[model samples]
Target chain A: MIEFIPSAFAATFSVSVLLALAAGTFAGIIIGALPGLGTVLGLVMALPFTYVMDPATAIALLLSIYVSSIYGGSISAILINVPGTPQSAASVFDGYPMAQRGDGALALGYATVGSFIGGIFSLIVLVLIAPQLAKFALQFGPIETFALIVFALTTIAWVSSGEMLKGLLSATIGLFLALIGPDAMTGQIRFNFDSLFLSAGLTVIPLLIGFFAVSEILYQAAVLKDVKLPAVTSGGFKLAPWSEWKPRIMVILRSCGIGSFIGVLPGTGATAAVFVSYADAKRRSPNPEDFGKGEPSGLLASEASNNAVSGGAMVPMMALGIPGDGGTVVLMGALTIHNVIPGVRLFSQQPDLVTLIFVLLFLSNILMLFIGGFGANLFSRMLRIPTTLLMPLVFMMSVVGAYAIRSNPVDLFVVVIFGVVGFLLRLNRFPPAPIIIGFVLGAPLEMSLRQGLILTDMNFLAFFASPIALILFCITGLIILNLFGLGNAISKRFRRKETQSNN
Target chain B: MQQKNADMLYGAVLAGMACAMFAHTFSPIYQNEFLFGDVSTVFFPRVLLGIIFVLSMMLVVKGKLSTSDAILTQINVKRVLLTGGATLITVVGVWYLGYLVMMPVGVFLIGLALGYPNLVILGITSLISPLVVWVILAKFAQVSFAPGTLL
Candidate 1:
């Protein structure tokens, strides 16, 4: 693979980075304020505009949007129980209660502070660690790439967030979707059935709009309840003072660390990051029960880690060309489209662009302070938008967005069909995330596996015998055991028998 | 809301999927002389599906479904159908009336269906929804969206 890295850091300054940051964050906030709108949709929808811009400027704008959207979701979750994005699921635990308790302003402030701290920490590491990882990743051949994807896929089953069956089922559905296109080995189409749309399987934009956007619109509207924001939250806004916040240092650092780890792991997404971070913060805190009851520390841990995860996910993607999270997959795709082939060699080849990316990453995280702190409360009123009007808009937007992907009627149709399928799956309590991941990763994985086999003469023994694959297989096996309640059973036995003594 | 313990449909669907997948595997493996690539590609995912199929069937047979974390017990079919139907209409309608007419019209109608009935609010909702998206998506981050039938 040819790697294209621009010359040394174009002698860029904080000014350009700041401008890009301001522009992107502002845009992200606006988009995020609209229910069912999100970072992925924001970034992907913005791709065409980048066609004419400098690579740095383009990357900066997109990265800023990525950073701010994580914070944007917090605005809604805190003011309204509805989480705008799945990652912000954690924010609702304490954020909503805080708002209800008349601490909406204070809760928003903490969320902003927590987001900034997390973003800044992850940015520093992204600059330092990404290049190192990239250099190492350049050494990988198709074998490693194939193995990496397999590992990512297997990880999803584990990340079913304590529900492996649901995860596997969703993943199976995804793989099935991926198989709809032509077979990689024989170049034969599987399920086209006289339609041109099936020839390309399904595009990401429409499906994303359908599952995440359209479905979300319907779901949110159905649950719509009219609740007023703090009649006036501005007067109540408080930072809680950093000196007083020092007790949360452990929570902040630990959550950031864990959040970054979660972000770097694919399929673990923000929702998982939020729950685990919240639980960990509570588990480690001096007062664990205070969580989910409007504790600022709970918000701190949840917000920081979740935001940090936004940046941290890029670490794996830039280094190994592996998508660290769903957002990074979009990022990696954006990079490739700009013809910036990922996987290591770019760090040495284009120090300038790399530096630009670093600066942009930093700028985006910092910009969140401005976006989340001042803009958040003002935007929080989106919760007040009646679902009746909101639902139709989301549906239309999904259709338009899906059709926009290829401008093909076929894609639009697929989006609608998937909308119904997605709705059906959701009704049945089937998680849609895994299936999306599956379809997204399936084709590439199948192609890679076949290519590897073709290279290795169809050796079935090759996959397991490889040390990395062996490790991945073993980990997947352990995850299965954990999901089967073996881990829970073991841990449960060790706990004191409070139930027996209660009587 | 308690999770509906009904697994009959879920189990049946999975079983059908498994049969199709297994049939695909069998056709290619036995009928074709050249099944290159590792057999695991064939065996692995299928075995995985077989396992899934069995698990789903067991769940269905036992009727042991659980909805542990869901806040809403049972989904309203009327709500789903109305929403889904309205979206389908808007999507299909756009190809004919164009994005502008269809979106506003769709938003207005669906809004009414969902019980939002201020024409002023509905009109503003339709206009601003796409417009706001336009500014953020096109002007800021720079991606193209559907030009639809309308500008």
Candidate 2:
């Protein structure tokens, strides 16, 4: 790990890689600053472009977008009341008030610096944790692997949305979609129904385009009312004095810790982290009443934590091939397309590539800070482009992307079909991440389970023989029980017993 | 529609899909017994569909007891249908006319359908955007595009 750093630094400083980094960061900021166009859609739109590039350059581009988009959301949140992404929702509370009082530049500055610190802080944590985690995961056998996947899927589905039942159903549907192709073990066609396309199975890139990009276009069409552009009051950056930031150092650091830790958990993402950090900052401040009234601490907490999540979320995906949230899910898809399969094997076989990813992430975050500050005015102007014109371009890109993957006309239909399906699912409050993640993990889940079963002579009880598998199964059971409100029921029973004992 | 009724309908559709999937397990392909283990190709799918069916029914029951409105409180049906219809046409057009010719017209109509008032900007964007994307994807990336017989 220590030796890889110099090599990583050399690779990251090359011409093409730097160009990709700069372009990706610039585009990411604009995308993040625009209301309604978000990080997921931006990543989806960029997916087609990566089809031709090398793995390192492609990853650099996507990582830049992922990191900067979160910070870019704060720009719109400060300049206008609208948050560029859901992750920036907490920024509006104090950011807008600051802008309203003619300190928009200062607010933007705090966000930029806080985001930088948080991003760097999370990268350090990732560097320290991911290699060790991957090393530990090398001990997992087939049964343990299968069990871990089950636990990950269950936990993601259960926590990803408000309605646990719907999330589970969505995951089940994804698993069913995966089973549509040929069976990996026996090479027998199960659900093809004699269609050649079904036998060939669905590819990951087209599925991601359909699920995220096409679905977004349909959703915007369904809900978009009038194109009323918000008034941009300020358009540049201004640094606050050291005295102003000196007192809030602890707040920023604590928020980074909260954000990175929460981001490491499956399914929570940056949205929850930002709010939790914001509330923590507010609670700890002596002048708590100033929280929603242009307090620098509030803005710092929101911006810092959300940006920190970018690094935190990548840890699990790199080490275990399990995405922590939606953005990382897309990143995982991009990695798969580039033939950089992220898992324990990735670490063992291709340590250099892993280091390159770590290096790219660090570079992307540092680049995001400079680009975000230097190009604030230009990104602010990007908000003026009507969603009308922007969306048509998005649709065109979606078409080209879906077709570019395999040059198959049939894939276009797949996009439309899944687009409609995704929109319908969204209407019913079903979280889409579980479906995407489930689809990603589906083959491995089936392969490992069958392999473990065959090795153990088809005795299902033998799956529990491994200590790791037993622990994973226990965790999965606990998650399911909590999802069904069983935890609450037992806690209530205990409370009642305690009341009786006190009497 | 009320959210509860919509949820019930959604649940019913999911249950119907589950039933269809469950029926597929009886087919010849899935019925083949495995040599290595008792678990067949259909075992995982059948289990998944069963779980989906059960949860979907639970959703129906819960929807029946609750008084919540649909998740989307307000939807512009006309716009959604128009946008969806226009997109379908674009796909079909791309099939018949190819990407170079069909994309410009498709984009223009979609923008129009989505209420872009300025035809000048919309028309220019529609025409130029496709060309730029084609050049990047086709020229630089070396991706192939279907040249329709008409084109």
Candidate 3:
């Protein structure tokens, strides 16, 4: 992998790849700055273009968008009092306050600089941790793999939605959707309703387009009121003086660490990281009372932590073939289209490509820093584009994206159907990310389970024989128990007994 | 509607679908014949449907036991339905009339349905954006757009 760095650089510096990096970064900033469109939708819209690009260019494009979009969210958070993406939700606590105080440029500066540092910090963590994680995963047999997938899916569901039951239901629905096409083991189709198109199974791209993009369109239509656009605070590049930043350096670094750590945990994403980091920053600050009231540290903590999650989230996706969030799930889907299967073997089989991904990510963060700074005003202006006007373009893009993948007309229907279903499910408060995660992981989960069962002579008990699998199963059981509040009950009982014994 | 009722309704509907899917797993379409202890193709799907059914029931029970006074988001039903209808028509239109033809109409109709107040902007964007996209994707990237049979 170390030796492959030179080639990775050579590959990345190509005209096409560089162009993709610049374009993707620019488009990502605009998309992220917009209120409705976020990282997942940005990736979905970029998917069709990737179909025509080579593997290197495609990876560059997607990686740039993924990194920059997370950073882009802070622009809106600063100017419009609305976080462009959920990951930036915490930014509004301080970002908007700063803008209201006529310090929008300085707030954007903190966000941009903090995001850059966070990104680079996470990239370092990714480079160090991913290959090692991949190496450890390579030792996992079918049973361990099965256990890991279950744990990942369970954790994702638990964290993704407010209602754990709804999240679980959404995940189950996604798993079922994955089973609709041909069975991987037997090549026999199931639940396709005898349609010629049903046998082939649902493609991730169309499903993604439907669920994220199209569903968003519908969801917007349902909720969007005919109102004037909110006034946007002025935005420009203004670096906070060194004196202003000196005291807040620790906060930025700590938030980045928190974000990177949380990102490494499957299913816990930037949204969780930002809030946690913000709380930590406030708690640790000497002037905690100043926090969240136009405090630069709070804005930095939110922006940095969320941006750091970008690199952190990719670790699981690139190493273990597990997506940590919706953005990574979409990124995983894009990688698959280019025949770049991300898993344990990815490290050994294509170290060069892995190196290339790392390099692309690094470059994307750098580009995000420059592009975000120079283009702040442009993105701020973009926030004025009404959802009414933009969503229609998004719909058109969704149409093109769905149809362009394999040029199958049936995919158009899949996008529409999933879009409506996604919108309806969202209205009912079911988290869409878990569904996409479950769908992406579904086939592999089933395959690993069946293989493990076969290896164990069809004895389900034997699945726990492996120490790794046993630990994973135990952790999963604990998570499920916690979800049901049984873990708390049991803990309370133990505490009561301990108190009695102490008395 | 109350959040509880919405949950209950959604849960019941999902449970019904799960049950139907579970029954389909037992259909003759699934070759029940086991080969060297390999499970049938229906095995995994059955397991999934079973999980779905259980979860759906849990949702219904949770809904029943709920005390929260939360209400579901108020949807603009007419706008949603009209937008959905427009989307369907646009997709179907693309299939019949081709990308170049239906895409602009689709974009325009979707914009109209979404209540974009500025008709001129909507019309220009609907017409020009598709052509720009077509030129880039079809000409530069070599993507093959849908050429309608009618055209």
lDDT of each: 0.68, 0.86, 0.91
lDDT of 3 at A133: 96
Residue-level lDDT of model 1, residues A92-166, one tens digit each, is 888888988888888888888898889888876777678777776666655666777667766766676555666
lDDT of 2 at B129: 88
Per-model chain B TM-scores are: 0.69, 0.92, 0.95
Provide the lDDT at A43 for model 3: 92
> How displaced is residue A283 in candidate 1, in Å?
4.9
- Candidate closest to the true structure, highest lDDT: 3
Q: Give the TM-score of candidate 2.
A: 0.97
Give interface RMSD, per candidate: 4.0, 1.4, 1.0
Q: Which ranges in model 1 have alpha carbons more than 4 Å from their true place? A: A1-20, A30-58, A80-86, A89-104, A139-144, A221-242, A279-295, A324-326, A330-355, A381-383, A483-503, B1-5, B21-72, B127-151
Query: What does candidate 3's lDDT look like per residue over A30-144, in tens digits?
Result: 9898889999999988887899899999999999999999999999988998889999999999999999999999999999999999999999999999999999999999999
What is candidate 2's lDDT per residue for A1-503, written digit by digit as tens? 77888988898888878998998999898889888788988888888888888888899999999998888999999998899999999999999999999998899999999998988988988888888889999998889899988888887887775778888887778777877777888888777888999988887777777777777777887788897766887768999999999999999999999999988887888999999999999999999999999999999999999988888888889899988677998999988888998888888899888889888988888899899888888887887887777887888888888887888888888988898898888877888878888888888888888888888998879999999999989999998898768999999999999999999
Order the candidates by lDDT, highest first.
3, 2, 1
* Residue B21 local lDDT, model 1: 68
**Tens digits of per-residue lDDT for model 1, B26-144:** 55433443455434435445655676687667556534545354443355556666766777787777776656567776777677666665778787877777667667656675555
